[model samples]
Target: MKPYNFRRNPKPLTPNDIENGKNFNEVLKAAGKPPLITPSALKWMGIGLSSLAVLLGLYFGLSNNTEPETSFVQPLGPVPFTSALINPEKDTLLHLSTGSTIFIPAFSVVNKDGTPSKGPVEIKYREFRNVGDILLAGIPMTFDSNEARYHFESSGMFELLAFSGDNPLMVAPGKNITVRMASLNSKDSYNQYYLDTIAKNWVPLGKDNKLFYTGDSVEVGNLKGQNLSKENWEPIKPVVLNPKAQQFRIEVDPKEFPEIAVFGETIFEVVPSEIAYDPATAELPWSDVSIERTAEKDYFLISFSGNGQTLKILARPVVSKSNYVKEMARYEELYKNYLRLEKLQAQSGPTAILEKELSRYKALENQRVADMERAAFVEGRNNTNKSVVYSVFSVQQFGIFNSDYPLKLPNARILQPVFAFENGKQIPATQYFLAEMGRNNLYTFKGGDKIQFDSEVSNLLVVLLNDGSVGLFPASEFGKIPSHAREYKFVLEKVETSELSSKKILSMFNI
Candidate 1:
């Protein structure tokens, strides 16, 4: 039939044509429209698909930008043993040099009856030599509270004495040694003034020899330890001799001694020039006198040999007293002023100007007290050698206060014993559980009971309880403890088994 209708019919439809037709119908049904395929139609379809892809890409990119990124980090391992100790290098202690040590001797004072004396006995270093005011001439000695004993650069002398008002009793009279000889040159009229000054202040040796010659020899000894009121002397009897007896005299020139210058009644000390001794003659030989004590009389006998003959002379030592009544009255007045100023200072409120005035008054008062103490020696000739020492028991160190917190122990390993309550009784932790928990001999707190701590020195006290809690206290507060309620007890919380396991793994890896 197709051959007969070749003109109208295209060669008979093949299997490919039928399959194409089925595909065309399926595409048309799915699209709900007639399916058309052309070069222009393909270009429009590709452009639509590109726009949709770009829109989808932009939507996803914007959503990603708004959302926060998440990251995962591994946990830290167990702490190292070296990082957990308290370092000694960080301690705040007053460290002394190696091999340095301080030592103080024990001292005490006693009365005449060998009982403890109830008075303040001051011990100080001797500052000046003979005749000078000690307080005015010296500096006050300063000392550290931590010092055990005073350091001695050389063998030093100390004055130990107790003041009885402004008077001083000759307890241990220290010695004052001097070998002085000088010559004085004065005007004729000034000589009488000098003599009067000497007679008023010093004790003269001879009865008729008050006006001494130029070449007189004078000897004086033991002027210290004298009374303050009266002169005590054992008079010497004049020597009586026969007509054939040779006469010899040891004369001292008044000009060859300590001199005095006077204007009206006021006298002043004058330094003198060099001295000279008159040559001894056969008639008046200068012999060394042998001092002999006699039971017949209350005086000393001096014997000598001159011109091939034996001779003797009488001698006596005088103990003179100096008057300090006026000086003592002045010191008492100064002490009253000092007390007044001190009371005023205590009563006044704190102010810079007032404080400055108080300070000035205090300094003046202290100087007056020191001067009074010094004048005691000069007024009474009371030496300090006879005084006894006394013992003083006082605090050697100062305490520290708490409130300084968060103490860290870097190198110190302080472990305490751990206790547990079982059957209402305190019991120590078992070794098995301690090993399982990875603990040492550390004390643990378990709720009840009071704890007391006494610190002997400045130190940091670290306490770690079983519940993984910690506490810190300063050395000062340790003594005042029981300061908290129920004394001090440890409280701790148990850690989870999983945490413990993780810790164990970290520890294993760490080693």
Candidate 2:
């Protein structure tokens, strides 16, 4: 009746049992006595099962929850949109920090239901100016025309969006918004295009009008006088005494001609001209006699009118023989004082007093030829500073718009370009971009595709690697490639994701 110890002394298998394939556990179960496991052993088994479950949960959880793939068209850096609140019922003129202007007419924005948008509307705008801006914005510069693909050489580009509260708005039918985009390129070679987001293409929107600044003309003659040196300053000549000529003393108002008032007593001597002045006309108690300066130096146009008759004659200011010697001494003293005051003013820098003094004597200097030449020079200079060229266009929809011209890609091609680091380590790239120095466009090529570029033009090669790092083959290296090479290996400078930035990318290409 003793219990069989299966671990120590188990029953020997019979020939029949062996033929029936009964193992040790089956034999023990059939004998009505099963092996027993202790609580400690069960506890250890539960812990082992739990550990396996936790390990499996971690593995599947990590496999299910992974970071999303980054968008290829996403901007490289932060480009914040400028927002403005505008009343949709009233005409609004929005001015951006870039000196561009947008004219939104009344009732231009409509709701999705085709009803006029009311109350305040939000306008979000941004501009792309330079190559860095365009690259950071991730805007596609390629255009398709007549079954051929061309790149867009942008002059200026902008994005405009409208919203009402949390809902998006659209342009009202038959209404359009006018945009005057401040452009750096003043040339009229660019045309307008509207980006179709859903279609992912740009549609032609006709030619853009390039408007230049037209303001008041700058008077170069006045500026020249104010900018003259003391050595170039010319003093007024002393009045000549012609006693033999028909001369008479006349009092000129000091306020009317302060320049003439500087001279002590002014005598008017009639110059011989086609029209002779009658002495009887001088004593006829003239109703009105006016004196004004003529084109000639020291010459005045004198007109006398009375009893419905008018007489016009050229007269020159003169001094009497008796007063000549005294006036000459007075002139020398005044001239010396004028020179001393001018030197003092020049030392004090440009001031209202100096400008007034210079302007008062500008009429006395004979500088017509010099003034004309300076005027042309100054006009050209002021055109750059005082005026801005604008690319004017009207949009019926709110989206990205560009003033651009389509340019064809280069005919030269290199098939299956192998991109590698400078140390000859091969790296895989997702996309490649070729940017010419003068063109505003960026030509994109897929990996393992043919790379086309102009050899004569300065070209910059940029590759987006599979690991999100940037690789740069600068314009200098691009120029060194031989024209006859069919297969090309691009030696690039690696730019890690942490160091990838708009400024760094621009500097690599020396933009």
The local distance difference test score of each candidate is 0.24, 0.64
Residues 432-481 of candidate 1 have per-residue lDDT tens digits of 10100111111212222222222332332233223322223323333443
Question: Scored by Cα lDDT, where does model 2 land?
Answer: 0.64
Single out the weakest 10-residue window by summed lDDT for candidate 1: 398-407
Clashes of each: 26, 0
**Candidate 2 residues 358-424, lDDT tens each?**
6654542324324433554566632323335567667798888999988877776655689999789
Q: Give candidate 2 misplaced runs (Cα > 4 Å).
A: 1-74, 214-387, 412-416, 496-499
Residue 296 lDDT, candidate 1, scale 0-100? 17
RMSD of 2: 35.0
| Model number with the top TM-score | 2
Candidate 1: regions farther than 4 A off: 1-114, 117-323, 342-417, 420-511
